[model samples]
Target chain A: MIRSGGLRLDGVTVLLADGSKFTRKLVAQMLAEFGVGTILEAEDGETALDALKRGPVDLLICDTLVENPDGITLTRMIRHDNGATYRSIPVLLLAGHTRQADVIRMRDCGASLILAKPVAPKALYDRLAWIARDPRPFVDSAIYAGPDRRHNVGEPPNGVARRQMDRERFADQTKSSVSHDEIMAILRQADSL
Target chain B: MRKSRFAALATRDGGRKRSDAVQAAESQLATMEGDYIAEADRLIAQLNVLSGAAQPDVEAIYRVAATLRGLGGAFGYVLVSDIAGSLCDLAERLGAAGQVDPPALLAHAQSLSLLHHRRVKGTGGDGEAQLCEGLARLVARWPAATLP
Candidate 1:
């Protein structure tokens, strides 16, 4: 891990799995600006796995097309790995243009969050905030072994479908900025998880 | 104390520095615009040379277009990104169908070239609109992920 000054996500070590050197440097710069230090870079899945062997990582920001195991398979490996820290650390998967099949596969593999390419820093921050605030319970089955896909924690167990609520919230949030309290509440809740 | 410091950093960032950071990122992305288009051209040429009888290198084309799409958008070239995205998506779909149409591939490839040229000229108005319309027509013919 490349350590630096005291900052948010400074204590939180990160592993970035991307094949492009330019992209990896640019992403590292962005994360640095976000107060993240100690970012470990990996050009492929093999490198990432090797890094995991050394110590724990707080988050994994990876590209979908990373070589070797590929991003999906890499995430699956981490999910299935017997190491506790590897299985539980948050993963944010990035893609250029995601297909339905890709989404289904990512969901099945148990990725924490999925973001599209050309990710705005604020959008990336929001997702990271979500991960830190509410580290969702993991669901291990005959297959899946990542964060629980069920995200409707506040939803009353009424007859209303959770998908509809999610869609409505997504539409609403897209229009305006998430409130300060909303972000902080998420931050404060990080410990409870 | 570590947690509070983290929170303070996060909160303090919601100011001019944040927008400045975003602007700086955009500026950096602008510098790499040429490289993205250049790579797209090379990839499209590879796709164009393929005979309809022989299989197009789907994985290779996908990698190029996907990189173009990501990098183009990262550097604030939405047109390049969107156009490359369409090509990438079509590549994936065609690869899935186990058939490659050279003519269709050429049109999409040329469109990226044309779009990049126009974008450099700062003529991203009606002319670009029409180019995208042409692209949309081709996209309509092919399978797209989020085709409207």
Candidate 2:
């Protein structure tokens, strides 16, 4: 997914959090091939947190089953770590096809993206592009904290149209009035880019 | 229309360079099959150990199946991953149920056994769909209520 604006990950530092030696080695090897500068491997969540505290990491490639604390727990802890230098690092969770309940849980736990495993470098690269381009602001709520889940419209395209009255009512209830400054700020950001 | 010979040569060289990179990356990945076999064999042995137990560790079985799910697709074994994926679903359901149905569990295990045992190609060759169809039936059998 090569886009207009360059999304070069050439010099970024990455952390690989997986328990299996083979999984960690393969992921690191692939990321190196992608031109990442520094790749660190952690076998558990505790090690991951320690690494984050010790260095400036741009991204986290985490496995769900990492022990001493799993990936979800690490994500939650990273999100909760206020004023810490490593709190804002983007986390990419590596997991299998998640059950519906776990999907919501992972989202709530602050995963920037979920890459379904057998990790294709092309898919991985596409995700990196998405993260670089899609500037989804963080959402802090009582129940969830991380990337905004509402970034996408929660409807499939070409689906049956809802009633006009229902649409109007829904829009009336959920719309937030934006300030002029807020709109201008967004416009300025786009212009600068 | 005249194409400059210099431009033509540059295009040829560029395409060759790009394809060469692709091939290098692919071959680098291809080198992991030995690792895959070793790790998979270890996991299968773990699964076999659990299967022999009067009451298998559902969480452990689920972990092995799930881990297999993650690894297969990365290494170009889509069919193997899909089979492992179905096994993961079954494992998760059985874990939630708090009781092991050994026969059903064994069925999923055997499906996985078929994957690694037979060395199904990563891109899904040699009866992969037929194999998956059999397991897909098993995956769909358990109702949604089985989820935790």
Candidate 3:
């Protein structure tokens, strides 16, 4: 259940990258129910990227099959670029098929969460809550470790080690069951030009 | 055309009571499952043509087939379900290939379209029931058709 008590995400912007008009309308309606102030819509990943360049966003909910670039590609680009203020922002990927492999791929690409399509309003709300109250702290604890002592150690220094640890943490967050072959096949069928 | 035909059949005989009309309409609704499946089949045919493009957007096809499988089963069109399942498998395969075989794809599309038309015309008895049976037969034979 979503704890709506302190859930005032007013003025937060949610960008949606979906080709389906019906899905966009449905998500907009669901977000409105949760008191989201402004909602932005994009038919594909290219448009969403352009929108991101213009400013920062609080959340991004994208379909796996956006018209251009595709959701995973868009997510990777966003995470890779440092100029984008929303680079670290939470991303929720919606997949038409609830394949575990797809979920894992999305997570690997830096998506905060993945939801199977035909998403229920309640499920969306719950995911939003989890994103909103992310408790993980970001810090440079390695700065506290001296280089000489770290050098004597077989592994890298604390900062480098912590960075690796963070990568592993995000890697573990991926939740996909679909085989790589299945995803590749779907991509092949969907690719144009 | 189909709706009109059902409406005309409903008006036949002196059973002109409102309740009788409602019952007739319900029966017609039950029988239209074949029509829906046929419509899906027609769409699949169109998809075959479109899929030959460089980037075919096959995910859309998979999504449509998934819907058909669910709805067909819900409406008691078991044959439709089977056909939809096969279509789903084909879509998955196409996705893996990342390309389309125009000739083979066209043949499969034609088969789906013809199956839909035959079921919808209810060439035999109770189009919906026959469609259900046809879908079952298609499913039984899918393993063979799907094999490389």
Specify the highest-lDDT model's number. Answer: 2
* Residue B51 C-alpha lDDT in model 1: 20
Candidate 2 lDDT over A84-156, as tens digits, reads 7777667889886576547657867988777767676555655554554445667776777777778872322
**Cα lDDT of model 3 by residue, A1-193, tens digit:** 1132334445667888887665576567666555566789999899999888885566789988676888887887787775456666667887654333354456457666676543444445546655554433321132221011122213212333432332343233122232345333333332321
Clash statistics: count for each candidate = 1, 5, 19
lDDT of 3 at B124: 21
The sequence of per-residue lDDT tens digits that candidate 1 reaches over residues A1-193 is 0112212454667899998776787677677666575789999989998897776677889998889988988998888987555776678888866665676777677677777776655556555655554435667777788777775644222212422332232232122122334323322332232
TM-score of each: 0.72, 0.75, 0.50
lDDT of candidates 1 onward, in order: 0.61, 0.64, 0.51
lDDT of 3 by residue, B1-148 (tens): 0111112222234322333333433344455445545556556666556545555565666666554443333233334444555556656655655644433333334434544444422122343333334334333332322222
Deviation of model 1 at A154, angstroms: 6.8
Predicted structure with the largest TM-score when compared to the true one: 2
Ten-residue segment with the worst summed lDDT in candidate 3 chain B? Answer: B1-10
The full ranking of all candidates by lDDT, starting with the best, is: 2, 1, 3
- Lowest summed lDDT window (length 10), candidate 2 chain B: B5-14
> For residues B80-140, could you state the per-residue lDDT of candidate 1 as single tens digits?
6777777777677777667665555556666566555544322244445555555566546
For model 3, state the Cα shift of residue A29 in Å.
1.2
